[model samples]
Target: MLTTILFNPEIEHYDFGPGHAFRGERFASFRRMYQETLAHNPHFQWASHDESATDEELGLWHTQDYINMLRAASLAEDDEDSSVPEFAALFGCGPKTGPSRQSLSVYVSRDNLNPLTGRLPEGIENAARAIVKNSMLAVDYVLQGKTDKAVGLGGGLHHAKANYGEGFCIYNDVVIAARYAMKAYGLERILILDTDAHAGNGTCEAFYNDPGILFIDVHQTGIYPGTGLIEETGAGKGKGFTVNIPLKSGSGDAEYERIFDEIIFPLAREFRPRLIIRNGGSDPHFADNLTGLGLTLAGFWMIGDKVRRLSDELCRGKCVDLICSGYNPDVLAGAWISLIAGLSGIKVELKEPVPRIAADEPAEIADIIYEVRKVIKPYWKCLG
Candidate 1:
């Protein structure tokens, strides 16, 4: 009956470095903004996740070798280790760019430091455990029937693979959560919807062989980690279950919502999954520096509204939200405020300002949106 939202100061321990886009302050600002917005609200109960994921728990999807490799990298204490090239890459620090080991310690071990604190973040392993375990805690609560739904005030680290990390994501929490539900709760069908600017590459990879997991990714085309293509549907039993809706550069709200209605919604209705997972990334907002896809505050509210409605109809209101990836402070704070407001059933003005894409971009976006829907229409009855 309650929608439990998970936000703890320690989640910020997953910080990359000072200049990196995935900084801890985003969580801090969002917490400040979220608390102020949802203050005195009766529909939402805010909470913290106490469980840190053990290696065994992480082994639900990640390999023991990958886990051990990161633990070794975390020991470096600085990012300058050239001896282990593969290990450096695991921490998002390759030969060309990344932090020195000191940058690795930038936000860790700071239970006494600023917000998004860690009791004592040893490094990426500590932060990864916090993110994944905290995410699972929310998942566990929803699956156990203690709460109907939960939203994590955490990044959607969907870019991490089963055996490696990529794109600032060390572990794929979306995949882990879905797998967790299936194995622990014995639920067969799970739906993962990723709306990040980048494709849910890692997530799609992990579940490509399994029919029980339906993965949907809607992202800007040709971006970093560009693997989600129109033809890359699921393989084997999972064939056609993996849906990739690649929006053209600068796609706007109308374009995005159209694809969702024609493609995503209809498929979801047909799938009738036992649980719904949303990787709520705001990087598509016009103001986000990473990508050009256009999403305003109203648009974000629409996404949350649509997803919430679908969960209520298809899954008895069971959903886990891993809020992720909006770069601008205002963008992250405002978009989330708008989104959470919708999910909580609160009708009010999200005071954050909305920015639009370039004037000419909307027309181009419309064409791209229509094309994407057409590409998938043959596979899904809802497209018609």
Candidate 2:
């Protein structure tokens, strides 16, 4: 049975404010979709997350200094007259400079703000721990032979770095879970498939030199965090282990499918991973305001099914999904539910058909894919 972990209470504390694209209501919308749609599927098993990670557990993938900084911010009790501006600026909390979307901008809210000192709650650290702990629990279940596939719907914080948070992510839960799987569970050669609209910069950084973890990110080009170029393969021992396919703007379902057929599937066959972790972000949907890529619910379902098939074929059916980013509440909710249903092997009635590829679009994307394969062919065993 598939075990799906939903940290409902943790969702309460993961607020990014009203106008922000990364609002907590997205989770609520997903939960509602599951209840109304996928709950009836017999093959799916839904699990709720009750436990959280301690600092010791978090230390597995994060630095102590960074963790301490988060703690200080959360507690609202200053460390010997530590100024807020000093810590906030260092932690990326000051006025936004990069992207200029009004919907994307969010100031500290009253609920999140510390009343005594007029500062934001230590929510980032708490949310980060919640993400890591929930992911660890899901990993443990899969490793112990409790479930072959699991989904941690609340924690996908991919933008979180080893030292600080960015792009609404804090603590890099996927990395921690991957580390836990390798160190505690004795799994070798873990594969991370990050399909977030934005590049998984933090995850790439975490495993940049680690050869054991195979990282593949298929993101939109020229987006937030400004990384994940096709040439930015892993360094040192991980030279060929990191693979990126940054799709051009407006590249949708056909582009994604071609990448899978030509690159992702073949590479997975070569690497032969023991476990697969999917960074399932649905923000690439055409309706999303944050991204430029145009994908529909059908595209997400197809990708989810493809990942499930890959797990069954390559990793003895061991896979876990960490929900990443998706801003449009309704579309994100629908896409996430579809992914869960698809991964769990449930029969879903299509609300909308997969977007059709124009005659010229596939070739356009294929040209890009061909160029990418040429660049990374040296790393793969038989791509050349």
Give TM per candidate.
0.86, 0.86
What are the C-alpha RMSDs, in order, of all predicted structures? 6.0, 6.0
**Poorest stretch of ten by lDDT in candidate 1:** 111-120
Q: Which residue pairs come into collision in candidate 2?
A: 74-122, 114-119
Model 2 stretches astray by more than 4 angstroms: 1-3, 6-8, 77-122, 350-363
What lDDT does each candidate get? 0.74, 0.74
- For candidate 1, report its TM-score: 0.86
Write down the lDDT that model 2 would get: 0.74
What TM-score number comes out for model 2? 0.86
What lDDT tens digits, residue by residue, belong to model 1 across residues 1-384? Answer: 577887655677777665556776787787787678775677778887556778888898888766765665554444334344553545555443322334323322222122332112246567777788767877887888878778876747887877767677777778888888898899999999998889988899989988898788989888888799877888888877888888777776787778778777788998889998888667888888777777788888888778888899999988888886887776788888777776656765775465454633443655655666666666566666
Model 1: runs farther than 4 Å from truth?
79-122, 354-360, 363-384
